[model samples]
Target: MAVIPATWDMYDLIQGVLQAPWYHMVFEVALVLLIVKIYISQSFSPEKTVLTDKEKETLVEEWVPEPLAPDVPDDHPILKSMEKYCIEGQNGKYVTVNGKSCINLASFNFLSMVGKKEIEDEALKALKVYGVGSCGPRGFYGTMDVHLHLEDDLAKFMNCEEAILYSYGFATIASAIPAYSKRGDIIYADENVGFAVQKGLTASRSHIRWFRHNDMEHLESLLIEQEKLDKKNPKKAKVTRRFIVVEGLYLNSGDICPLPKLVELKWKYKVRIFLEEAMSFGVLGQTGRGVTEHFEISPDHIDLIAASLETAIASTGGFCCGKKFIIDHQRLSGLGYCFSASQPPMLASAALQALKMLESKPRILVDLRENCERFHQKLMNMPGVKVIGDPISPIKHLMLAEPAGDPGLDVRTLEMVVDNAMNDGVALTVSRYLEPEEHLPKDPSIRLSVNCELTHEEIDRSADIISQSFQAVLGKLTTRSLDVSSPLNSVQQDNRSLKASR
Candidate 1:
């Protein structure tokens, strides 16, 4: 081998390579073109391959899903078609539905503030200033001055140490629950709790034990059983946190939970209590402070109070208020509050204005309670109808005495009565349970939501229409039952006559 200098010139190596073979350059050019061609071909080709039938079948078997059914069955009672109404104005005691003015009993506008000029004006002003959305979560530059103000006002109104706002009403309790209670924690929930609470309980992934709705004794029994279990599993129980969740006023059953009893149980069992006051926040108590105020119980007793602004506040968010330590935890831990976009400034302003109206006009609460009582008293005597709920509750459930032998038919019949009431110039609604898999009332019922704006005559008229519709439906049902039994009765009578003759 010839010896080369340790540091050979780069030019000398290039000259040697250039002189070695012209085919090398030709080969390099061809290779480069080939690479470019392959790249271009792949880029232009479709992402997926056209497979043979057998290959396709194998792939489908591995990855494809079976055909999906409809989200709701066609024969589902709630799917049955009925007259749909579109409100053109404020959702108050009376609303213009589908171009016809109807007495409204279908809305949750308990304080009749949805379309109030003052609230709307405030919302409009905020809209002009803030445009629309906060554009990010509260933790990420999404906390507006209005949001902080509303939270402060809510805390003051509820007489709590602190309050935190959620961008949505459903997300409020759902986020709050899981924020504190995690896996291995135990939650004692009511069977009749609303879907929101159920979702929260599910998200928490906690050990959930359900008790009968509004049955304090049943709740106490569950607590006792849980205590015993904890005692048996002392090691695990020492680390496990226990919670009792209840609604201030249940949406499905339209009944008030015995909060005083729940507070008693809370102390007795040494468990935390979480109250979801979506419906009762502005409908209960003389000052509309909800179940705690109604029962004259200190707000400090409840571990956490979560409520929706969508209802009586006529807004689009929710809040959780309690001791500073409890609410402050959700700032970092609540998934919805930490990740979701903040509520629009307009909606928050509307809620704040609604709260002011509530404070200024306490008469609205009285009016709402009176309307609820009057409706309850009037409907209590109706044939084949049983009114279920507290007399002061704005929500009432009128149940059928005898179901039409099927859930769908029974719901349809009650819905028909609601339709009839609508036809008679009144807007009414049927209570639809959100969770069918969970324990529900045996029979579905019509839900009438009373608002403060409803007048005496309006209430009376609504009661009369509901009464007449129920009576008519009941008469037809009775007639059909009699006709069904007529043949059996006739056969029995013929047999009796023959026996006598013999």
Candidate 2:
């Protein structure tokens, strides 16, 4: 051992020790071990905070929130008393409800193809081949051959250049409208347009000017006003696209749109026409081509036509047919088509089969028309009940001669009448608003969906039952009014007298 002088200091001593063979290796190993120990301690450190039982309970009580109640009252008498009728079998001309068979005047199976064996067979075959669902949106590898075939068939049937499919019937028009119309655009829509169109209009963020239902004059007046406004602001008007949206057949009123007049106005106002034919397709026209064929106008005259397969096609989806350019735009822009899972192959195949059947057997349409006419004629003869809609339309509305002074009472009376009809083995429905916020028909009515499968006997029986039910309900209401000594008793008495006269 060398004795270190005071002046030689710690530096010289450290140099001497580092020069030893074991010193450097031992120091390096110890340093590495110390670093490893520090890393292990920090990396595995616990993050959770430990608390006593009392602390935990206080924390939980502080974090918990009070239960919230709904803003709207949930205990309305009508709502509480209403029974939801569930069908156990196919909703065709007749359905099984709660294990009892009832004639289905409520379903929209206008062509009676919903439970057809042939359509079911096609659907079954497709299901076996393609499984239950498409599992992805149309743009994301979800386009099946069946969907394409159905689109092509629809295009050919409508005599349009192209067609596009949507997964849901309601989404067809809802997505199509927003795809073309955006904020700052103007939409001149019928006040009686279905709820689907109203939703689309809302989503489009467009300026909506509602014209009276089937009132071309009001529409024209609105168009004239728009024209004047456009003339005043030529640049803004040039940029703003205007559209005239109408239903081929109005669902609310059960009336047909004047297509020729709408087309004339479209050209006159230089506005694009969007026809929602959900209720008319496969029910109208010589070949079931829809309102355009029914009116003997060119399909090309309308910019876009949207219809649902759920109605006469007896399927689950919907379609839009137009020029290739117009329909192609929806591929990217239509939210429902772009984002929703594609329509199942089975449903698409079913729709295709239904369309084929419609084409091969044109007699179905004729039968439907005849049934509608017969039913309309019978309903016309009924007292205190006014029939609404074209004679050829499958949809019919039977309204009261006079409202019961109170909307709630009117609804209650109509509901009672519907219940009476149901009890008599007829499955009739009241026309309730799909969107209550929108303007609806003045008087609530019972909506009867006539199908080709409905026999003349069935039609007559339904009308008779409906008339008797109407009288019974009115008579009961009149009796109640008499008991109350209300002014409405006089009106109810008059209605009873009219019923007796009939």
* Best-performing candidate as measured by lDDT: 2
Query: Model 2 over residues 1-502: C-alpha lDDT tens digits?
Result: 9786786788787888778789777988999999999988855667899899999899998995656965555765436445456668688788876567788999899999977899999999999999999999999989999999999989998999999999999999999999999999999999888889989999999999999888889999999999999989999988999999999998887899999999999888899999999999998898888899999999999999999999999899899999999999999899999999999999999999999999999999899999999999999998888889899999988888887655655777888998888788888887777435665545677888998988888888888999999999898876777674665665566667876899
Worst ten-residue run, lDDT, model 2? Answer: 75-84
Q: What's the TM-score of every candidate structure?
A: 0.82, 0.82
lDDT of 2 at 255: 91
**In candidate 2, which residue pairs clash?**
none
Instruction: List ranges where model 2 is wrong by over 4 Å.
Output: 1-84, 434-436, 439-442, 485-502
What lDDT would each prediction earn against the true structure?
0.87, 0.89
Candidate 1 lDDT over residue span 347-459, tens digit each: 99999999999999998898888888988899888888888888999888888886644465677678779878878899888777654555554568888888887788888
In model 1, which regions exceed 4 Å deviation? 1-83, 481-502
The lDDT, on a scale of 0 to 1, for candidate 1 is 0.87
